[model samples]
Structures are given as C-alpha cells and as structure tokens.
Target chain A: MSSFDRNDRPLVDVRHLKQYFNITVGPLRTKALKAVDDVSFSIRSGETLGLVGESGCGKTTVGRSILHLYQPTGGEVEFEGRLIKTKSDINELRKKATMVFQDPYSSLNPRMTVSDIIGEPLDIHKMYANKAERMERILELMDRVGLNSEHASRYAHEFSGGQRQRIGIARALALRPEFIVCDEPVSALDVSIQAQVINMFVELQEQMGLTYLFIAHDILVVRHISDRIAVMYLGKMVELADASVIYDQPLHPYTRSLMSAVPQPDPKVARANKRIVLSGDIPSPLNAPSGCPFRTRCPHAAPCCAEAMPEFKEVESGHFVACHRVNEL
Target chain B: MNKRFTMHIDVDAFLPATDEEKAYMVQMRPSSTFFRDGVKRLLKNKVATVSLIIILIITLSSLIIPAFWPYSYESMLGVRPGKSVDASFNNLSPFEYGETEQARIAAGETVFPHIFGTDSSGRDYFIRVIYGTRISLAVGFFASLIVLIIGMTIGSIAGYCGGKVDLIIMRFVDMIYSLPDMLMVILLATVLKQTLAPVLEGTSLARIGVNIISLFVVFGVLYWVSMSRLIRGQILSLREQEYVLAAKAAGAKGGWIIRKHLLPNCISVVVISTALQIPSAIFTESFLSFVGLGVNAPMPSLGSLASDALNGLSSYPYRMVIPAVVISLIVLSLNLFGDGLRDAFDPKLRT
Candidate 1:
C-alpha cells in the first residue's frame, strides 16, 4: 500500500470492510446481522465518493466502518499510507479523518455552546497554544461555516436545522481533517434547506481540498456533489463508476431498477420513463438469500444467481458492476 | 449531459452593511449558556419567583434572627439555682408578659418582650422555633447532598457501563427499594444511636447528638435509592444520544464524555430531583424526631418541640400549633419552589 504513488493514492482506502452486530433472537439464541458485509471502496485526495442506497442498505455502516467508528469485524482501512489496525493508528487517523453525522439535532450536544462543540476536537488533540488561540480558531471555523461569531456561545437547540448542520460541519472541520464521511448530512433538513447545506458542503470541500464519502438515500443529491458513485443493495456494493456513467448507463439489474425508480421532473420525460417496480420487500438481513443478497427481488434473477454471489468486476474504464448477467444485460 | 443551473449574481449585494447586521444575519442571539438560559426562564416564572423569595426570607430569618435576639433558645429566662420553678414565666401566649416582665414595665425598666412568649420550661418559644428551623434546613441540605453524590456516581457508572455492572447495581437498588423505608429507618436509627453514642463522644459530632447522627445514617442508607434510580433512568437515555457518540468520535475519553456531555444534559433532572428531595428529607427528619428517634433533647428540633407541646395541648393548644405551623410553612415553600424549578429548568416541560 505504501508503494502507491503519493499524488495518485486515495485519501481513504477501504478494502473488504465488514461490520456485524450480534442480536439475540430468542431466550438463548444469538444471530449475526451483517450490517456491512465485505464492502470495499476508496476516495482519492480532494475527491467526493457518493454512496447511495435505501434506508437499511448499510450505506451509513460503510461510512462508519471506514472511520473505524464501529470496529470492523474483518478487513482493513488504510488512510494516508497508514494501516488503521491498532488503537494508536485509529487515533492518528481521527486527527486527519472526521465524520459529519446524519441528524443535526442529535449530533450537537444540546448542553454545549456552539464554541465548545466546535472546539471539542481542538481540545481533544490540544491543537491550540492557549485559550485565546483556541477561541480564534473556533471563531475562524464558525466564519468558514457561515455561522455568526455570536452563535459561539449559544446552545444547539437554539438553532434551526440548517444552522445546526453547519455547526456539526464546523466541529468536523475543527481538526482540519483531510477526509470526512458526511453521513446524510442534509437528509433531516427541509428540502429548501437541503440544497443550501449541500451547496455549503461542496463549497467547503473546494476551499479546504477535503475528500468526502457522501452517504445518502437520495441519488439526485448524491449525484449533485459526487465525483464517482457507488450503489449498495442490502449489505453488498452492486455497482460503482463515474457519477455520470452510473446515472446514464447503470449495468447491474439492481442498479437499473434503482435508477428507474428515481422520479423524473419533466412531464414528458416522466411519461416516457418506465419505473421498474421491485415486486418483493427487501428480505430481512437475518434471513438474507444464500447467494446474492439482492436475488430475492431482482427482476432478472436466475438459478445461477442463487448458486453464488457474483464478483464485483470492472468491465469498462472506471465502471464496475456485480451481477451474473452483466454482459447479457 | 445535464445542463448546469448557474445564474449570474452579485455576491456582495447580500453582504451586510453594518457589523451588527452581519452578526444578526446568521440568526445569532446574544451568547448565553444553558444554565444562564435556565435561570432566565426561572426568574420569569411568577410562582417560582415568589416561592424562591419566601424560601430566602425563611432561611435568612433562621440564620440571622438568633444572633441579635435578647433570648436564647435553651436558656430558662426565670429559673435560677435553688429557685422554685417560675410559675409566672410558664406557658405565656404570644406577646403576653409574665409577672416579672409586667412589673418591670410598670417600673419603667426596659425589658425585652418575649414575642412568642415562654414555654413550660420558661425558655423563649420564638428562639427555639428559629433554632429548630436552622437545624431542619441544614439536615435537609446535607442529607440531599449525600444522596446526590452517591446517586450521581453510581447511576452514571451503571448507565454508561451497562451489562453486568448495571445488573448488579440495579438489583441492589431493587433490594433497597423493597425494604420498608420508615421501618428500616426507625430500626436503624434506634440501633445506631446506641452504637454511635460511644464512638461520637469526643468528636465534634457529639454536639449534634446520637439521634441526629442516626438520622443522617438512616438517610444515607435509605433515601439514596430513589435518587439513584431517577438518575440512572436519565443517564441510560442520555448515554445513547448521538452527541455522546459525537463526543466519542472527537476522541473524548469516557470520563470526559460523561462529565462534559451526559451529566450537563441530565442536570435539569438532577436539579429538580434534588430540589424535591430536600422537603422530603426534612419531613423524614421531623417524623423521626416526633417518634423520639431524631435530634436529642435541648437542641429543639421542630418535631421535638411539637412533641413536648403535646403534654400541654389542653391548657395551651398554641404550644403544639406554633411548631406545627412552622413545619408546614417550611415544607410547603420548599415543595412549591421545587415545582417552580422543574417548570423553569426542564427543557421537556418548556412551551
């Protein structure tokens, strides 16, 4: 991994990362729920990799695993030429890598003033020489995030959703991290506010030269900022490619169906767009299919689909798809 | 390719002209902390404000009134060595004068009037009541402090650690809960009074009396269970909040997370619970004293004063009435103040 070219190497290199939770099903019985199973992706320096899936498709889990938020059951994440396996490695990675959580309301501590919330990372890492320097840094962060200096001493509950999200972003940016996993950072806000927050995120990324793994269920929002996009089904990554290629010519059956479900805005285009309605409900992760996790509801499922999970393979420049009938489709 | 939705605009047109406008543009208010905001809300509540005033007045009177008053709570005004019990000084009603005081007034000598008159022992009843208020308030505050310290520590540890530690502590809490509180307190106080009497002989606590020590011991043993359970419930919910997770993500250690995030969020509950606990503790101390298991004689706990008054109830009903009224006033004001604190501080109750 260290042999990779400095300029070309990804800021975050995640390989086969898995996160499983053991939940008790009965009085004495426990089962492993594979929240994130053998998921692999990477984000280059100063690039945004968008991860899109339905609510329970493990998109957030993928983001969290890369940051070592939940200790991975298997596989490894290499951040900036460092294998994040040991506690010290993870702690070091945290200084350079941070997360902007999904819910603004829950992410910022209500009892904490905005200054303390944003200054927490600095305090943890001792980034300042004195109180004055710390306050200056916090004020700088607030300014970058478009928050007023006066907001520095106000509580989280006093802000609206968009402002609270900005505060969360300021805290995430406090350590001057290079990579940030933005886990649905704007999903909890109103649609009008969502666009503003997303624009702010993009602007911040450009100004700071930051890398992002933007996770969301909304493909349109993901496409707006993502340089490349990965589509996940259940706990598996089904497709990955350039953002335009993934939206324009998605290859996997699950990807095709997912693309078709997105509502077209133009009336004429909407009439022509045939929505691929998936027939069955998403199978419980507790009782996932024997082979492909998406086989139960795939429109093009076959006997071979149940025999084994299809390998994710790149069939064209920068376009990867995981499906048995990828060539035929 | 999707066409970019770009519009030519002058960005500076949106910029604020004045510094104040820039500050106000981001929906920012004058900076204040959670405690300050809570206090602001609390001061705005009329009932709570009045209750707080009443509590301050009573507390001030208790502390200061004893210093300048002409009479001592324990001093027998008319009794002297080898003198017969001063019949004229016994059981005078409020503002009434005994024979000596009446004669002094007629002779143009200045005599400090016994405002609440004298008790059967010829001691000034008003001073004793003042002293009793002081003792009760101190006991209530100290007892609640003990409960708060023990409860906060155990509850946060249990709530944060969960699993085995939680189970063990919660079971212990349950065991304490199942015990009959009053009966246990009485039994423990009686037994402890006997055992602690010798141990406390030379210490400064000896002045506090054996029954008072036993009462504190009973409080330490029994009263903390409710506080711990309340705090545990609060911490259990707060520990799972995403802010705690965010704190963890920021590389905050467990203790720091608990101190900076979890505890502050749970402070309103802590404040309200501790406030409510004081009146109950005072009530419990008075009850123990009433049953002869509280502060020893001559200290004049409100309950002891009332109990002594019972023997003279037929002759002077006001004897028992005075202490009873004082006890009710103190308890009522504290309870109302607690309710006010809850209404003011609790975010969940905010409109």
Candidate 2:
C-alpha cells in the first residue's frame, strides 16, 4: 500500500498450492494429511496480506509452503514472477524472504546469546565485511526492535516473552528481507504486549518498504494489519477481499459466521449484532467433508452444494467467495 | 498527555524520552551466558562440589606423585644379575625392612617404608599402585573421549538427516546392540592385542602397551552405541525446535544448523553422558585387566595389580585391598561427580 503502483504485478503469487504430509497409519499403510489443499492467493509488493482461520485450517502451512519451509506437494509459488522450483531458487528466495515464528520460546536458540541470535542471519548470508561491522549491524537491529544494547551478551532465558519476540524480530530483520511471513508473531504474547509488537511490524513495513503474509487466528489482529484478507477453512480458501470489505460485506456463509463472531465492544452494538455461532466443531482435515469441506456446517447447504466443490471466483471488483449459493444469499 | 480526555494535558509529560531516562529505565541485569549460569548452579550443590574436589585430589595425586617417588614402578629392590633373590625382600609386610634394607638401616643408611608393602615380586608396591592409578585414570578419560567424538558425530548426522539415513544408521546401532557386550570386548581386546603387538614394538607407543590400545579399540567399537543413542534422541527432538527451522529459513545448511543450534542445545546431555561414561570405562578396563587382557605385564594397571595380588592373598590381604580400594574410590568419585554435573547442567533442573 505504501506507493506500490496499483497496476504492477503482485510481489508474491501462489497458484494452486498444495501441501500434503504422509503419515504412517499402520505398519505398512500410509495416508496423506492434506495440510493445505489447492490454496491460491497473491500479495502485491509493499502490502500486507492477512491469512485468517481457526486452528488446523492450514493457515500456517500456507505461510511455510510459500517459504519452501515445507516443500509443497503440488502447484507453483512465484516470487518476483520467477518460479520457485529449484533448490537454488529456494535458497535465493530465503535471502529475500524470511519468517517470524509463532512461539518466541522455541523460535530463538536457547543456547545463544541475544547478539548471536540476532546476528545469525548475518552470519548465514555473510552480510558484513568485518567483525566490527557485524557488531554495528547487530546493535542497529537490536535498537530497531527496542532492545537495550546491554542485553546483547545475556542468554534468551533471561528475557521475558515480549523481549524474546523482539529478538526474533531482530533476526528476521537482519537480512533486510523484502517479504516476511509472520506466523502469529503476537498471539503468544499478552494483549498489552501484542499491540507493541504489531505496531513495530507496521513501523518496520513502512520504514523498509516490506511485504508481509500475516497469518493468525485472531480476527481483530488480522483486521488491524492486513491491506487485504483471505479466509481459509479446512485447507481451502473460502473468501478473499479488502480487509474492510470482508468485515463489512462478507458473502460466503462461513465468512459471514466468522465476521459475526467478532465481539462488539459497545453495549449498543453488541445488542444489535447477530452472532452466527456454528453448530458443530470443525471436522478433521484428514476426513474433511467431500465436495465443499464446509458443506456439513454451511447453513445454506443444498444437494448441489454437497455434489461438487464451489469454485473460488470474484463476484465484485476485488471480492472473491466460494459458495454455490452466492447469488441466493 | 490527557488531551484525549477533557482534562489538563501535561505537555512536559508527553515529551519524548531522553537518553538518560531510557538508560535509567533499562534496569539491565548482569550479563550471563549459559555456561556461566550452569557453573553457578553447579557450585550451589554441596554433594557435587565435594565429589568434584575428591576427583581432583585423586587425579592430581595419580598424575604428580610418580615424578618424585623414590622407587620405580618396576624396579626390584633386592635382585642382582649374578646373585640369588634376597628372600626377605620378596614378601616384606607394610613398613617392614628387608634383610639388606635392615642391614642398611643398621649401617646408618635409610630406605623408604613401603606404604602398601611389597608384592611377591619385591618391587615397590606403593609405586605400582600409583602407576596403576595413572593407567586406570588415563584409560577411563581417553576411552570416554573417543566414544564422545564418534557418538556425537554419528548421532548428529543420523538425527539431523532423518528418513532413510536415520533408518540405516539406527539399524546399524541395533545390530551393534544385539552383539554380546562382554564377549565382543574380550574378543576385540585379544584380537587387537595380537595384531598391534608387532606394529607397536619399536614405536614410542610401546611404553603404553598393546593391551591399553586394545582396550581403547574395544571401547571405540562397542561402548559408543549408548552415547550415540543418547545424542541421537537429543538431536531428534532439538532439530524440530523453531530455532533450527529459523536457521533453515535463513538459508543455513544442515551442517550449520546442527552445529549452531542442535548440538549446543544438547550440550548438557553430552557433558552428563561423558561424565557417567568415565566410570564404566574405567571399570571395563579393570575387568579386562583382571581377566589377563589388561595392560602388559610390569605396566601395573589396577586390575593387573589386583590380579597379581591373588598369588599372595593368604599371606598379604592388604595388597588386594589397596588396589581394590583405589579402583572403587575412582569409580565412586566419578559416578558421584557425574551425577552432580547432570544436576547442574540439565535444562529441566535449571533453577
């Protein structure tokens, strides 16, 4: 959104991305766990794309697959219009793109000092010419993330959750990456600290002209950061639109229910809001309902809705939905 | 500032923070690394501290005492080339003077008292005990070191690679596991002794003996399985840590990730396992020595000394007691100290 030409090609384009993990069900029998099935989306350069869903809906898988952290079982990921296919391409992609993991405790190497953890990316890419230059860059990164330079030599365990997350952000920023996949970077923090980290992400994006694929289950957080939002259910994307349009005029039944579920802060708005609580728990992806994975829970389900999967198609200029009854609803 | 509310806005309070204020707000803790923290915790444990001290005393004595001792480890005090053995020197009890030594004392000369007395050979039993300690301690440490190097390498490779590599390496480990442990050690020791004797005959290594080298070979071949399995399990879990993934995301290679992230996380396991391994390695060396596969004759390993003491047991039980007590003390102190180190460095046990 920050001065990216509206007509320029998207910085990242995912076409029919599929990620399936094989699990041994028995001694010789194996079954595929379709973690992300036929998900497709695109994010313009200098824009934030928010991916939202409940747990186990493959939102995180989509982020990881784009980074080639998990080799996608099928389809293509295009970065700067180049197909990310070869090992070297993935390595090249890694330099320009990075990720901020979900759990701060598990994300930073526990044995490393704060300086080493933040300097790891620099060391990996050979970014600095000399030791003093490396130290200078490390101090700059730490300051950007609001960490005290004095904390450099201390191990990660000495810091609180918020501070550890700052260290993670510092590492992600060390390579000066253009694209970052933030996999619930703030969900692990307290609500008060979450705001600080999210604001820092925004500030960094503006400062560095960075692009982000922000994946989270927290709808409010996604709404706050995303220029455009995509909703996924059971490894399939249900809707995609501008953040405000999705929140205000959701078309798909699942997206409608998800939107209604957001709590209204004011008593008057709370009384006026109609909460569309779904009937059953989300079915496991391993045995997700055939045709439309959401058909079993869709209130507007018909015989036709269960016979063939709905195609995710654009109805308006920028809004997309995948429901057979988009016209009727 | 209270500008958002209908109240007095303190513009001074809303001013940007200064360097002095930020520095004051930092409240930084003293810088500490993982090793320093582990050591700090280790010193707080009394049992571990005492055990560590006892090990130091024993190790220092074994290393330093032989340099200045009066009698050589193998020199027989009373035998000459053209003369018969001085019969009284052959089996002198503790502090007892031999026939020639008594004559020397009567002639205003001096002889050092045998603290553990003479064995059947008439060599100074005290020096033999000291040399035996040196051999035992050396074997214990060197064997464990070999196991650590081999096991850590194989384990990290197998664990980080996973899949087919993991399957093949793990099967090989299992195959080694199925072998009869004691039989393998004895068989390898005998075979190594036979093969290495001629090759080592003229080398400086001849002083260390073929049997000790065989003991090391046995440990390298068989004893590493447990350490490998331990490190493999540690790596298997640690490789899944997000830091490893983060490194991978930063385009770091598998070897780099294993070295920078996986191995460092499991250092506690390595230290603790190696410490525990020393005692067992020492015990194995002694057991092999007891069965006549220990260090060569005249070298005086604790097990070989004890084995020789069997010939004089009825007349001199203390010879048996002395070497046996030394072995037991070494193993005991090592075991206790290893436990202390584990308690100190283990992440779960960190205070």
Model 2 chain B: weakest 10-residue lDDT segment is B1-10
lDDT of 2 by residue, A1-329 (tens): 34443445788999999999998889999899999999888989889999999999999999999999999999999999999999999989999999999999999887899999999989988999999999999999999999989788888988999999999999999999989999999999999999999999988988898999999989999999999999999999999999999999999999999999998889899899999989999998888888899999988899998888999999998898889999999
> Which stretches of candidate 2 lie above 4 Å from their native place?
A1-7, B1-26, B31-34, B80-88, B349-351
DockQ value of candidate 1: 0.51
lDDT per residue (tens digit) for residues A228-271 in model 1 = 99999889999999998999899988888889988888989989
Top-scoring candidate (DockQ): 2
What is the TM-score (0 to 1) of candidate 1?
Answer: 0.89
Residue-by-residue lDDT tens digits, candidate 2, B280-345: 999999999999999988889999999988987888899999999999988988898888888878
